[model samples]
Each structure stands twice: as structure tokens, then as C-alpha cells.
Target: MTNKVIQRLGLLLAAGTGLWGQGSMTVTDAIRKAWVDQAGLKAGQAMVDSRKAEAEGYRDLRLPTLTLQAQGVRTNEPMMAFGIKLNQARIGMADFNPLVLNHPDAIGAYGGSAVLQQPLYTGGRITAARKAGDFMAQAEAASQERRKQETALAVVQAYFGAEVAEQALKWVGDTETWVKGMEDFVGARVNQGLMLESELQRLKAFHAQVDAQKAEVVMQIRSARSGLGLLLGQGPVDGALATPLEPGTPAPAAAPARRPDLVAAELQAKAAGEGAKAAKGNNLPEVGLELGAGTLHHSWSQKGDWTWAGVGVKWKVFSAPDLAKARAAKAQAQAAKDMQIFKEQQAEHETRVAREAVTAAEARYAAAKDALAAAEESRRLREARHKEGLAPLIEVLDAEAAVQGARTLILQSLYELRVSRASLDLATGTPIEGVQP
Candidate 1:
């Protein structure tokens, strides 16, 4: 029977979608994998690209720009014909002999110019834009970090939750079998007139209760399987997770400072501040420089020597009603600063809560372990006493029930402790590092 059970376990593991190695997959591994695989993380990454482009656009502020322009014309007559004398040129319209102009191959409208422009200043728009880019990048980066961190935490919770359910199922299965065995044993004894029929009936009642509990655990496992699938990026229709429901091994705590969520929040605040600065800078004047070159030929042959060059500048020195705009920007900055303050407070609160949960779970686990041991001892004593005719069958049954109950409680408490530990790592800004499952 033991070998058959092992074979069944193997078959289940082979069919399961989320199993890792020979044991239940680690929570940390599951979380890190989900973080990298979740669609939302990829979407957040796209935002980062946009922010980078915005920053690159800002870098263009200090660089020169060049534009190329070209035009072609084969007119019946020059739109602005210039009658070129041997040594002179005229601005007004004049018809020259087509043959003579043709000899020089006049190209009245066939010229291209390369124009260059430089932003010398923008009433503070350029500076503001640069600052805004910086902040925007920071914000997006922070947002990405936040997304990754949240994904990790979510995966951890879901993975361990499924694990707990699996463990529960195993516990129920074992207890149910044991209860059935007890019933059969009592029936055999009663058939031989060694135990009362009432004792057999009581054992049967206990078996029924165990069966009910087992059914509930099975349903719980199904729900847990769905959650685990989602976290591992597997579809719910995949074979349910079938890894061994072993107790989780301890994982080392990470450095609190390395917490991604905390870093992300910090970056967000910085980004917000930058945005506010950019808004304020919008009121400043912007300056720019422009340059262009053009050449016109009198004939298609390009004998006409005509050239032009120019440079210009601009500035937005003042706006009479700009106070409202500046004030609005100031208000926005203040709001962001306030948000930063709130975020910091929230981080501290989460950290404290995580610490308390870990402490509580640890204490509860210790207590449950002791209770389970004591109950098992009591049951053993009661069973011996009943066989010796010193205890009633009801007392022995009661003691056995207590032992089973303690086992269930211990399982629950252990799961709770591990879950709490995972939460603490997340809350304290110390994520468990792990490879993909």
C-alpha cells in the first residue's frame, strides 16, 4: 500500500503543471517567477520606455537642429524672372531670351537649403522640460519597481496558500483513513463480543466526521490549485499542483534596504518633485537661434550665382497673467510633497505590522506544537488504559479525537507562521531572492 501511494504521488507530480523537483515549490521561487512573467510587469516596462524617450527629447534642448528643404520648377516662364545683364542683376520681373538664358541653363526655382536652429532659451520651458523629464523617468522607474515588488508578494501569498491547502488535504486523508481503521477495529472487536456495539457505532460516527472533513479539504485544494496556477502563469485547466506537501524550509531574511517597493516609493517622490519644478519653470522665457542658406540659379545649367544666408533669435520675456500658472504649479508640487510624506508613513506602518505578525505566528506555532505532543501522549495513555479495562471506550475515543484535532491545529499554525514570515519580508522592504520555478 505504501509503494502504491508513492507511485500515485509520482503520477500526480508528473501530471501537475506547477510542481518543482520532488517537493512543493518554494514560495520565493514562485514569487520571483511571477514578477518577471506577469503581463502587468511588461506593461509597466513599456511606460519606462516612454519615459526614456521623453528624457531623450529633453536632451535635444541643448543641441542644434538642421532642416533640409528642396524645390523644383519647370515653368513656361520664370515665376520671378530676372533679366541678367552682362554685369548686373534685376530684382523685378524681366523676360530674357530663352535661348540666351538657356545657354546659361537658368534654373529659376531649383534650390535646397539646410536650415539650422538652436534653442538658446525658453522662458523657463526648456529648463522646466528638462527637469520634468528627469522626474518622469524617476517616476516610471519607481512604478516599475513597485510593480515587480507587488507581483513578487502576490505570488508568494498564492503559492504558500496553495501549499497550505495541499497539506490540509493530506492531513485530512490520513486522519480519515485512520478513523476508518478505528471503526473497523471496533466492529471486529464487537463481533467477537470483546467490545460493545455502542463503541463500534461511536467509532463509525468519528469516521463519518473525518470523511466530511476530508471532502472539505479536497474542495479547498481545488480552489487553491486555481490560485496557484494563476500565480505561476498557468491556466486553471492545467493539472492541479501535486507536489509533496512537505514542511517548508527556512529562508534567510534579505537586507531591508534592498526592498523594491520602498525604493520605488522613494523614486516616485523624487519624480513628483521634479514634475513640480518643471511646472514652475514653465513661466521662464525661452530663447532660440535660427540659421538658413539658399541658392538660386538663373538657368537650368546653374550658371547664375545667387546665394543667401541669415540668422535670427527669439525670446518669451514676459506674460502679464503668468502668476496664476506659477501658483498652480506650486500647489501641485506641494501636493506631491504631501503624498511623499504619507507614503513614508505607510511604509513604516507596514513594517511594524509585518514584525508583529511574525512574532505572533512564531508564538502560536510553538504553542500548537506543544499541544499536539501532549494530546498525542494523552491519546496513547487512554488507548492503553482502555485495553486494560481501566478506561471507558468513550474516554479513549475522546482522547483520540483530541489528538487528531491537535494535529490539524498544528498544521494550520505552521502554515500561518510561514505565510506570516513571507508577509514580513515584503512589509519590511526585504524581498526573498529566488530563481524562477
Candidate 2:
């Protein structure tokens, strides 16, 4: 049978075995599955959730705090004994005698108090802290988005890689079958005295080479499938193509405004700036109001109740550590700003490169398609000439090889074009759903 017939038969057998049947997976479906099942993406989302919870906790600082406490003491010290009596409202005029004060008896007392504290002012420290929490939460959200885009890019590459490898394997298998048929034809001609034994030997050697190439292509397909499976959180998978391999739509003229990583960097820089502000606020005074209601009893027979309200102020008049910390925070903020600028520049460069790659890939794919058509025409003409005794068998074999090589190039270019489009989407931070491929 002719090589084309054999290849068709092989495809029929493959289909019967379900390789290209209903079990096929589309690239879009694979990406959707990975988005739902990928462990790395899940972990990133969890981190965002954790940061959001932390930010919510920080925002609670604007509310009042309440505390309850109980205490007991017994001492012969004059100060402790007098204070205990005063708290229990059990102090007597005679208890002020110098003799009792000099040698006071041991006294036991128990007290409990419920206190509420409300911050009145914190030199903007509280506000800065809340803002920092918000910024950090934004940063985490951006990071999660970055992770999602990365995962989508990874899926696109792997899906295309698997498709490329599958096509290579199929092409190589077809070429191998064609070489085997040539070897048998040459062997028969040699036996019939129409071809030399050396020609048949050469054909056999070429057949062996094709076989080895087929083996390599098989391995490539296997490896590609394994990698794609891992990315999809499946151990391994094998199937025929469900999505057509083609170059996607070109990117828009203007790049996307918010690449995930750049957004994350900007938010992180803002968070750092807020932290610096909070650090500086450490040197300023803080004011708060404290309200308490309590009961104290020196004995079962004696008890007293009291309520107090007061304003409190705390000022760090001078502290070397606080100054150093403020300086360090400012330096960190500066570093973050510099990093953000660098990231922005890098992103712009990457977007430009990816756009160029897409253009180049489109050109290459068009060229490869033309070359494949030309090679097939050459192969058909050479085969016809050989059948008519106008061309040598070697010339026919060479033309066939050229056709196979051109087909391989076409396959590669097609997949490369797809990959370049994916890269462009990634560079621009286009959402996965926005990716045409």
C-alpha cells in the first residue's frame, strides 16, 4: 500500500482506539480545569484570603477596647495596708495614727474592675496602620492575580506543546511507514534484477534512520503529555487534538494598563510608604480615654464600689531606637519605590518583545505553509517521474524527505505562533478569558 493509504489506515485505527474520539480535550477546557484544580493557584487564593482577614482585624483598631480584671493582696507594709483600706472604703480616722502607720497589721483585700479604653488621637499612627493594612491587602490581591495569569500562561504553553509533539509524532510515524514501503519496493526490484543490491541497502539504512526519528518523536509526545497532565493536576494523559492549532488574534495597539506584577509592586510600595508614616508617628504623642467601674472588699462585712473616668497621654520624648526605626522605614519605602519603577520598565520591555515575537511568528508560519505546499508538489512530481523511469528512486526519496521536513516546519511554526500569542497576552497582563487562543 502507498504511504498515504497506510497513514490513513493508521489514523482509522487510532480513531477506533478512541484517541481522536469523544475523549479528546480542548485547550479551553484544560485551562478551565487547571484554574479550578491547580494546587498553586489554590494556595495563592488562600493567601489573599488570609491577608484580607488580617486587614479586617487591623481596621477594628478604630473601636473601643474593654477589659475585666481581678486582684488580691496582703501585706504588713503601711502603704499597702492603707491603700487596701482606701480601695475598700474601710479606712477609719484612727488608722492614721503614727503608731498604726509605723507598724501596720497584715491586711487582705480583693478587687475587680471593668475598664474601657477609647483612643482619642494617635498622631495619625492608627490611620496609617489602617491604610497600610488596606495597601497590603491590595498587594496580596494583585499577587493572586499574578499567580492566575502565570497559571494561564503555563497552561497555554503546555497545551500547545502537547499538540505540537502529537503532530510531530504523527508525521514521523507517517514518514516511517513511507520509508518502510520504499525499502520493500527497492528490495523487490533488487531481487528482480531491476535495482542494485546497494540501492536496497541504502533504502534499508534510511528506513532505520526514520525508525529512530519516530522513536524520538514518540518520546517527545509522551513527555509533552505528561507535562501537560501535571499542569492540569492530572498525573498523565493521552488524547488527540480537540482544539485547532492556529495563530490567535493580534494584541491591541496599547498595552494593558495593569499587569498583575506591576500592580502588586505598586501596592507594596504604597504599603511601605504607609509603614514609614506610621513609624514616624511613633515619636508623636498618643491620647486616649479610660473609663472603669470596680468593686473592692477588705472582708465579707466590708465592701465598696467606685467609678472613674480619665484621659491618658503617652509621648516618647526621646528615643534613639524610635528615630532609627523611622529612618529605616523611610529607606525601605525608597527601596520599594525604586523597585516599582524597575518593574514598570521591565514590563514595558517584555510587552514590546512579545509583540515583536508575535509578528515574527506570523511571518514564519506563512512562509512555512508556502514551503509545505511547494514540498508536497515536488514530492508528487518526483514520484511520478520515478514511476515513468524519468527520475531516479534516490531523487524520489529526497523529495519525500523534503516534504516531511517542510511539514515538520509548518507544524512547529503553527504552534510557535500560538505560543507567541500567549506570550503577548501574558506580557500585557490580559486576562485569561481575553486570550483569543
Candidate 3:
């Protein structure tokens, strides 16, 4: 079978496997498949989940914590020995004697306690931490959205690229067929002494050129298929264009805040600001309520249970390290804010550029369509004139070449137009499904 026939069979198989349809894969379907198959998108979603889990952990800090602890020790030191006895309610007059206390025999002490601590005040540290966690989660969520958009755009480019390559290959094949017919016609004329042998040779050379062009286009089609397959997390696939290029109106300019990347950047800055607040909390006093119930034993023979409750205050009056950390956090927050502003500006610029590209591509595609029509009409006239012996074979060949060139331009311009539209949708923060044409 010819390579063209084999390629067609491959496309049919691809369609049967649901990678694409008879018309080729639609942009919507491509985007949907990519969302489900793309490993990068899955990883992005996992990161969002991780951030959500971290946020939940931070939020849990507001609840009281209960802990159980146990310790055992054997000591002969006077102070420790006496304290153990006292805790066990086993103290005696001998423990008060200086010599007896100083040279007391070692005694084993064991203690188990359960304590509950409730934070009454943390100088807004917990609140700030929770806010930071929430902001971080939001940032991750935004980042995941951006990743989806990017994946959709990539699918658009690859899908259309394959379509254009397929069309170009078809054009080359048709040109080759036409040239072959011309060669046969000219060879008969030469045999009849009505055409020169040089005419047949020229036709043969044109056929060779068309064959070379066809080979290159075949490779391009394979490469395009490979790219699309990679984006869909599959092996190389072959398909045809399911939908024609229909350039739609450009999307209106959207605020930078609507862009997922810009939103993520803004959230990151907010998280950084919360981090600064949490760091400053280190300089303030922390207060909490602590309650404990425990039993102490001396030699396992004497034991007593006791309950105690108290309010605790912790203050870091002067810590150089904490001060430096707070300052660093403030600087980081400032930097994050600056980055957010820059991202907003960049988003706007990108959107504007994408809009311009779409406009230009649409215009080029329109012009190419018109040129193809004119070229096709001219080729028909030239071929008719050649049949009537009123035009030279060379003129007919030139018209055929013009027709093929116009077809090539049409395919390329259509590809560019579709890709530019996808880019504009991405820059405008429009969902893939919502992107028309």
C-alpha cells in the first residue's frame, strides 16, 4: 500500500479507538482528554490537596490539646530524694536531718501526668498562621487552574498542528496525482511529435519535488501526532480535522485579577503578609490555661494523686534571633507584594499581545482563503485552455503549483488562527470549554 493509504488507515484506527473522530478531534474533546490524562495537571491538583491539608492542620491549633507524659528516675541527691518523698507523701523526720539527707540512699520515683492546655491568647499568632495557611491553599488552587489553562492551550496547538500537517500532505498528494497525469499526457504528445521530450522531463522533475514535499509533510504529521499524544498521555495518534477553522470575535480585555497566575501571585503575597504578622507575634507575650492530674510513687509502696490548674505566661522580652526573623519576614512580604504587582502588569501585557496575534492570524487566514479560491479558478481555466491546445503545458503546470501553494498557505494560516485564539482564551482566563471557535 502507498504511504498515503497507510496514513489514512492509521487515522481510521485512531478514530475507532476514540482518540479522534472522522472529522478529527474537536478542541473541546482534546481539552477534556488532556485534563483527565495529563500528569502535570494531576500533580497540580495533588499540590492543591496538600495545601488544603496543611491549612486544616493549622486551623486545628485553635482547639485545646491533651497530652499524657510519664517519667521514672532513681537519685540519691538530698534535694531530689526529699522532693520525691514529698511528692509521694512519704516524707519523714529523717529527710530533714542534714547528714541523713546529704547521704540518703537512692530511691526510685515514678510519675505519670495528663495535662490539657488551652490557648487563651497567642498574640494573634494562631490566627495569623491560619490566615497564611488559607491563603497558601488559595494560591495552590489558583496555580492548579492556571495549569489546566496551559494544558488546554498546548492541546490546541498540537491538535491544530496535526490537522494542518494532514491537510498539507493531502495537498501534496493531489498535486502529485495531477502532475502524474500531465506527465502521461505530455509523453503521448512527444511520441506523436506534438510535444518536446523536455516537457516530460520538466513534469518528471516537478513530480519529484512534490514527492519530496510529501515526505517532509509526512514527517511533520508524525511529529505533530506525537506531540498531541504526549499531551493526552497516550502513544502517537493520527487523525483528521473534525472542525473547520472558524475565527470568532476576540475576547474583551479582562482584569489581571481574573488571570489564574495573577490571582495566585496575589494570594502568595497575602500569605506572606500573614507570615509577617505571625513572626511579629513572637515579640508579644503568650498566655494559656494548663490543667494537670497525676500520681507520684516512691518505691511503688507510697503514692498520692494531685490535681492542679494554673494560667501560664510566656514572654520573649529580648531575642535577637526572633527580631531578625520578624524583620526578614517583613522584607519577604514586601518582595511578594512587588512580585504580585509585576505579575499583574505582565498578565495585562500578555493578554494584549495575544489579542493582537489573534487579530493578525484571522486576517491572514481570510486572505489565504480568498487566494486559494482565486488560484483554484485560475488552475481550472489554465487546464481547460491546455486541453484546447490554446495554452502551453508549462502554464498549466505553473497554475497547478500556484494552487498547491495557496492551499499550503490556507492550512498554515488556519493553524495559526486557531492557535492564536486558544492563546487569547488563556490570556483572558477563559475556561477551555468557554472558548468559542
Candidate 4:
């Protein structure tokens, strides 16, 4: 019996430590790990990269384009044969004869050409296109940052959720231990004929109830840990989480900063405006320079070569389709500006609500602390009174229940406070709990 009691005590000790024995991680560490591992964040980063590449492509439109062409052709038709011979510089005085020109023999020529085209001006079309692309890329980058912040917020919830479950399990274990001691005491009283047998039976029933509650808490702990693991981009984690579920320092009171999503919306609006400008630019004149060099050879040893350079200008003058496009672009720009305004307002509302939530959580935590203290003292008094036969067994059990309730409330309030702080950080575009990258 002595060995059994010692072993049970040791097991309880191990359970307490085992909740966090495998590894330790701070909230900051978990967020950083999630940022690197989370699939959603990775996808968002890919989108940002794609947008940046597109922007580079748009910017490269200002660079000249060079093209190379090669072809071989044979023809017996008079005009085509004569043209090929002229281009190949194989035409002779006899080739100019009307009779020979009308009935030319089949001839084959191999031709290769290199052409370079440089845009001299296109009104503001290229400039606006490049600017629009740059702005859109910036918007995507901002949106990605917002995604990271959201992922961090999720990590906070999962990390602390596991901690809360583990902490609650420890408390439930304490309740179980207390109920067991009561059962033993009551059993001894009934054996001595001092307390009714029914009283001992009641204590045994309450001990069993506590044991059931402990089992439920254990299941909760496992579930919470599994959820945390999934959020970390790993499957179920067997290692104990290092961060404890507890209240921390409150966030400094301040006005909310511009959130990343809001910035993205603003940038998107700017991009749309630039797109409108680019669309209108399409109606203006375009000027360019073209350079060409080519060679035609009937035989490699005897080839003809030519080079030419020229400037060209083209004007749409009046195209109904181009006019409609410009009008549609203008409308789209207006719509984007409106959407940006709406997003700013929405962001402001979210920040205000998050601040209120933090305030409410703080108040709840303070009240819970007071209730926990009173409930603990009340339980102590009831237990002491019951020992002296001043209080009934039921009253002692009720007191234990009250203490348990108060402790649970305290834990819940602490969890809420921590979550509210993180929520506020997210709303204000702050790093989660001020954790820096």
C-alpha cells in the first residue's frame, strides 16, 4: 500500500510536467515557424512573386525587340521567279527579256532576315502600362503581408488553445485528487460508525464523477494539441508545447495604424487609375523606329544582302472600339476608387471593435481573479468545517464545485485576454503581440 501511494503521487507529478515536458516554444517562435511552414502563406508568396514578374515584363516593353527570320522558296511563275532572282542579285540582262520573264525556269532562293523594332513614342501608353503593373505588384505584396498577419493570428489561437486545454487538465487532476482524499476519509468514518454509510457512498460517487471529468479534460488536451499541430503545417504533434496558456502584458494603448489590406486596396485603386490612363493612351499616335538587314542566296558563294532603317508613325484617328474602351476604363477606375474607400472604412470599424474586445477581456480577467480567490477561501472553510462535523458532506462537495468553477472562469478569462490582445494587434496591422520578423 505504501509503494502504491508513492507511485500514484509520482504519476501525478509526471502528468503535471508531461504537459510541457517534450519541448518549449514561445508564442513568437510558433508564429515564426508557422509563417515559414503554412501552405496558405506559401501560396500567397507565390502570388506576390508572379505579380512582380509580370511587372518586370511590363517594364521591359520599353526595350527594343529583335527578330530573326529564315525561309527557302522555289517558283516557276514569271513575277515570283523574276523577283527572287532580282533579290538574290542573280538577274542578268537576258532575265529582263519579256520572253524569258514570261517563261522563267524554276529557281530556289534561301533568305534570312534580322529586324529590330524600337518604340520611339506611344503617347503615354507604355508608361501608364508600366506604372499600372508596378502598382498592382505593390498591391499584391501588401496583400501577402496581410495574409502573413492573418496566419500569425491563427497560430496564436492554436498555440494558446493547446495551452489552455493542458492547464485545465492540470486543474481537473487536482480536483480528482481532492475528491479521492475525501472518499478515503468518509470511508474511514463509516467504518467507525461515526458517519452514515450513505455519506461514504456519496463521496465515492463524487470521486467517480471527478474521474470522468478528468478523462474529458484529457481528451480536450489531445484535441487542442492536434489542432495546434495542424495549424503549424505539421500533422498531429506528439511533442508538448512549451508556451503556457496565461495572460501576458497588455498592449500599449494607441490609435490603429494602416493595415496591410487597406494599403493593398489603395494601391489597387491607383493601379486601376493607371490602367485607365493606359487605355486612353491607346487612342493616341504611336511612333517607332525599325531597322532591317537581310540576304538572299541562290548559292552560298553568291549572295545578295540589304539593310534598311526607317521611322513610322500611326494614329488611330477615330475608332469606335477604342473610344468605348477608354470610357469603360474610366468607369473601372471610378469603381476601384470607391472600393478603396469602403475598405478603409471597414478596417477602421474592425480596429475599433478589437479595441473594445481587449477592454472587455481585461475586465473579465480581473473579475475572475477575485472570484477565484473567494471560492478557494470558501472551499477551505467548508472542508475545515466538515472535518469537525459542523458542515454536511453536500456543502463540502458544493464548495469544491464552486472553486472549480471559479478556476475555470479564471482560465477562460486569461485565454480571452490573450486572444483579444492578438486580435487588436491584427486589426491595427501590428505584428502579432509585437513579435517582429
**Ranking of models by lDDT:** 4, 3, 2, 1
**Candidates 2 and 4, the one with greater TM-score:** 4
Runs in model 3 lying further than 4 Å from the true structure: 1-24, 97-99, 239-241, 247-257, 299-301, 384-394, 433-437
Count: clashes, candidate 3: 2
Alpha-carbon local distance difference test for all models: 0.61, 0.78, 0.79, 0.80
Which segments of candidate 2 are over 4 A away from where they belong? 1-22, 72-78, 92-107, 248-257, 299-301, 387-394, 433-437
Per-residue alpha-carbon lDDT of model 4 for 1-437, expressed as tens digits? 12232233223222221121136777777788778887878888999999999999999999999999999998999998998888888779999889898998899899899999999999898999999999999999999889888888877777766666676667767877887788888888889888999898888777776666667667666666666666667766656666656765655756655788999999999999999999999999999999999999989888889999999999989999989999999999999999999988888898899999989989998998999899889989999999898999988888877777777677667777887888988988887867765
In angstroms, the error of model 2 at 389 is 5.0
Instruction: Give me the overall lDDT of model 4.
Output: 0.80
Instruction: Return the top candidate by lDDT.
Output: 4
Error of 3 at 305 (Å): 2.2
Worst 10 residues of 3 by lDDT: 12-21
Worst 10 residues of 2 by lDDT: 12-21
For candidate 1, give the lDDT of residue 109.
Answer: 53
| Candidate 2 TM-score to native | 0.86
CA shift of 67, model 3, Å: 1.9
Per-residue C-alpha lDDT of model 3 across residues 42-82, encoded as one tens digit per residue: 88889999999999999999999999999999999888888
lDDT of 1: 0.61
lDDT of 2 by residue, 167-227 (tens): 6667767777777777787787778888779887777777776666666556556666667
Clashes of 1: 18
